[model samples]
Target: MGKQVVAESARRRRRPTKQGTVLTEAHIVETALRVLREHGSAGLTARRLGAALGADPSTLYRYFAGMDELTLAIGEELIGRALSGWLPGGDWREGLRELGLRIHGAYLAHPQAAVLTASRVSGRPREIEADEAILGVLRTAGFPDRAAVRIYHAFIDQTLAFAALDAASLALGRRARESDEERWESTYAKLPADSHPHIAATAGLLSARMKDSAYPAALDMLLHSAATQLAAARAADRGASGTSAR
Candidate 1:
């Protein structure tokens, strides 16, 4: 048992495999994502990854503890993509909106991977950085710590939730996805107004809008609410200042 542990540790320290291929953690993660893209989450076995990298299956253990650790790395990669080249501007609202959109876009770009990692809290560098950046935005915008934390929690959770939901739809096979979308037009649009009055009245709109992800609209609503709260907080602070002066 002791010898096995030492052997595994030695393998982990070796970067170059016997196949003459050098494997870095980043390279492994990139290969894993490609495997995910081509064959999906379930297909991302150690054997498959090793074959894709032209290395032995045991070579993967050098970088990742197991498939679960690799999955968290994949999730971190998505967050890194979202944060790449992102600079927060003066307007907190706009900055946050852009961040939210980038996150949603990154996940949707890799729907197969997103379906697996969207809900996993990686606690990795990229994820921690994103949380810090978001909190900084709210704090710099004059929100108190409590309010910033509350809004940040809701903002991040809502963004990931929508990303996972939309990714699931995108992960569906083409025929299945098309059939699902067609239902909005074929079934809902044809519903009788007498029985389903509200849906029937908005059937046209539903057909057009329901086919799209609601993340953008939902993000705007959340930002609007936060703005209102900030305004009220500012007013209360001013009133308190005035009372203190008197």
Candidate 2:
């Protein structure tokens, strides 16, 4: 604890930017996020971050050990934003549903940053709190410890995996993205029925649906499965209690 305090004190030493502004860890992280958004993932180099903050690149090392640490911090910032005003209602299924959506929305909001950080384990305070909050929702909703842990693992993994997958599509170059969109309509929709009967039969529907994300549908499936498990567990408990009474 003492070592952590000393390290944090050292990290927080205020430095002056080239633009005559003051630099803090928050400022650097925020600027890095903007850089990632505006310039794409590759643009998030130390030199670029330094230029964005109007400070030397080396100055960032004071707050972060390296680019990896900074990236983790950026990921944590996204998690923090996702949970900002979110409180779980008593309905466990709906609560998990909303939390999953909030996280997906927050990451999709910054595709480049999301692409960089979605698969990472931030292990920061916000990330830890988010995990605890989800587990708390499951436990309080009457799930046993083993079941709660299983569901919690599935919930977090599915949410983040979808976020990363969707964000990758969003992070594509403008021309590449346009090409992908065009192919769905001009190529896939126009395929000959004889050679690809199933796809051809559903081409109209598939083309219409391709533009939207699959995350919502996927999240609903997970929630439904969890609800089924909870109901089954309850039924099993009732059966056991009835037998004991007899």
Clashing pairs in 2: none
TM-score per prediction, in order, is 0.93, 0.93
Error of 1 at 114 (Å): 0.4
Give the range of the ten consecutive residues with the poorest summed lDDT in model 1. Answer: 1-10
RMSD of each: 2.9, 2.5
Model 2 lDDT per residue over 181-203, tens place:
88878999888999999999999
lDDT by residue (tens digit), candidate 1, 1-246: 111223433554355655566777788888898999899889999999999988888867766777888899999999999999999878999999999999999999999999999999989999999999999999999999999999999999999999999999988979999999999999999999999999999999999999899999999999999999999999999999999999
Task: Report the C-alpha displacement of residue 93, candidate 1, in angstroms.
Answer: 0.5
Error in Å for residue 197 of model 1? 0.5
> lDDT at 236 for candidate 1?
97
Question: Candidate 1: where are CA atoms >4 Å away?
Answer: 1-21
Task: Judging by TM-score against the true structure, name the best candidate.
Answer: 2
TM-score of candidate 1 against the unseen true structure: 0.93
lDDT (CA) for every model shown?
Answer: 0.91, 0.89
The collision pairs in model 1 are none
